[model samples]
Target: MSVLLVLPIVLPLLAAALAIIAYNHRTLQRIVAVGALIAVVADSVFLLLAVERDGVQSVQMGGWPAPLGITLVVDMFSALMLVISMVTVLSVLIYAIGQPGVDQDQPVFHPVYLVMTAGVALSFTTGDLFNLFVAYEITLAASYVLITLGGRREQIRSGMTYIIINLLASTLFVVGIAWVYAATGTVNMADLAVKIAQLPSGTQTALSMFLLVVFGIKAAIFPLFFWLPDSYPTARMPVTAVFAGLLTKVGVYSIIRTQTLLFPQHRPSTILLVCAGLTMVIGVLGAIAQNDMKRILSFHIVSQIGYMILGLGLFSVAGVAGTVFFIFHQIPVKTALFLATGLVEQSTGSTALSKVGGMIRRTPLVAALFLLAALSLAGIPPLSGFVGKLGIIQAGLSAGEYAIIGVSLVVSLLTLFSMIKIWNGVFLGTAEDPTLRLAASEGETRLATPLLMRGATVALVGVTLAIALFAGTLFDLSERAAQGLLDPSAYIEKVLG
Candidate 1:
């Protein structure tokens, strides 16, 4: 079981090495990347089951003791995250492989993508703050390459903004780590959970604030998300989907972990609630104002983040559980939407709402997929999004957080409106204008989307539906994860005993 925890992180690095060795052989690179992700998904599933059945799991590296040696730990939360992330990565890799020009333009894509997966895996499993920061750097470095793969002027410009912002976040993370270590005398999360409670109230609050700002920026919370709308929509489809699906969630996961484990006694719930409200309102409004599919989705990323943060801010069992379930729900829905839009872009040569229309007539499958995902994202009933939001709203109501509850409900409505805007602009109306018809015809005739791309996206759509169908079981797991987070004594014991 302990060994299984390392495989998710290690196998990807190994696959990356193999990919680099076989750089000239695209088929081999594809096989290696896909194989590695398959293995990671399997390992993550096993880890989730093992943790659920047994308990929290931990292993010390180099045979060193806890608080002194490097440590890896897995509870329901981390294991679930690992599973979803690996699954999403695999799906996106398939989508990328099927794209006509991806391999031709980016020979090193497989290796770098695998490295990024390794980084995300490492971040989820690492039991220390320093390693978490290291993991962020690893992921961010690969993202810098992936984001600017074609080196187009727009991509380079957006990548530069991404780089500068993330670099600042990284610096703050290091500073936060230093402060944590100085205040708590150890950087191990489990040990810090124990020691942090011993610190003076002022020091604890101050450290929590520092960490919050660092993660807030990473998570693209309100007022800190200026770079996301510009950066995400400029990247290629696969890159954008993966980033939307995974990257910001990592920051949200860290916030949940740290707030629950190290600072449970000193939660800054009020401030988080305020941020949550603002992030929700601001993000959705930005989405409503966007003219392009990718940019609208990008802004919604910021808005949807508010729901997760709302769960965290509520700081209760139901709230955290709702957040956990929401994370799982959002991952696939968002990724599928991105891939669906990618399909639209491939089929019509444009994601601009004004230029693309009548996609439902040309490619009903893509339009249907996008509609399902968009509806799910808008919190329609019987979908994972509705379930997650209902849980959070229920939790919020119980907690007397009426303000954020109002904000969240309004955001959901606005989210639906934005989705409708896209549906109307890109899928609904006629494209009878000669020039637009000619461009659509050329796009369909010359750049037809590959079956594999659609297949990968459909697979993600299936996952979202599965989440909805299995909502009871997944929500139970999330509740258990929230319980573990709310009371970290067992986790601390498992790591330190």
Candidate 2:
């Protein structure tokens, strides 16, 4: 049974090799990629259920002892993250397949994308700090290929910024790992949790703050997040959609994992609260300023991350559970929004607010999809976003965190305003030119979005609604996960034993 723990990481990698071998046949490559993701999604659901049934599940690679051999672990949090992330990427892959033309190395796209998937799986499941770094590198390396896949001038420009920034973060991650190992005598997270508590209070605090910055940069939090809005908008819509949906969330997952486990202060963290406030305000403001559909969505990705950090700052089970639920909401909603924008670009030919309009008449289904996702993103009632924001706000109020909660409310309003800007500019108003000459087909008739693209977007939207409709069950799961995160003795024992 424990052997199944490795499948999440191994399946994509095995498929990636197969994808490379099938370069001569695009049909076979597509089959390989899609089939592997389906297996992963099924496996992820199994893992989540198993973790729920069985408590924390962990194993040592090559049968080595704890704190000596490689470890891979799955708790409620990891399992949930795995499930959501896999579902999101699967949607993005389907969306990518349906994109009829532009220019991308289709053969290489399959392998590189699967490698990124494996890296993301590793990030969620690895039990040690060093391997986590390895996971990040693997993900980043694949991303470097993906962001630049088409070799466009814009893609290359943004891809360079993305690469240089992540490389620096990767360097700092290594340094932080070195410091942790030198201080704690083990890189395994469960062991580090035990030993880190034994260190000098001063040392613990310093290490905590230092690693926060390292992962913060990766997570695109606050001042460190400047690279993201600029970087994400330039990639192919599918690439941007997947990156928006899953990659930064991986960083958030890292922060939640390491901070709760390694630090475990069990109270409000002033530093995290401050960072959250700043990230929320700044990111929304950036979104408001953007005239492009992709940029606006990209900026909101930064803003929404603040809420997750806000939940973490409260350092309570309720707060973290809210954070967990929010992560679930963000993964699909954000991906859906980006994809809707991609659809807009496809139909009208440009994402710039000044150039495109009246898409509601042209592509009503896509327009409806965009509005549903937009409203969800803005925390409207009865949607998944509303529930996530409410969970965090209630947690904050309970923790007497009124100031940050107020900031969050303001940010929510601002977020709604920016989303409205997109709706007005892209869907509601008249196009700057009715001819729609910018569309790929080169006539007044806009490009017809593929059935697969529409189907994939619909699937994601359905996921969001399902999350909202089943909020109670998901909240129960997130609360359980948060409880495990709060008191990780169960996690530590499962790993170290």
- TM-scores, all candidates, are 0.98, 0.97
Q: List, residue by residue over 47-134, the lDDT tens digit for candidate 2.
A: 9999999999998999998899889999999998999999999999999999876224457898999999999999999999999999
Worst 10 residues of 2 by lDDT: 437-446
* Superposed Cα deviation of residue 95, candidate 1 (Å): 0.4
Indicate the residue-level lDDT of 48 in model 1: 94
Worst 10 residues of 1 by lDDT: 439-448
- In model 1, the Cα lDDT at residue 470 comes to 97
Residue 143 miss distance in model 2 (angstroms): 0.7
Candidate 2 ranges with C-alpha deviation above 4 Å: 102-104, 266-268, 434-445
Candidate 1 lDDT, 243-361, residue by residue in tens: 99999999999988998898978989999999999999999999999999999999999999999999999889999999999999998899999999999888777899888888898
lDDT value, residue 247 of candidate 1 = 95
Alpha-carbon RMSD of each model: 1.1, 1.6
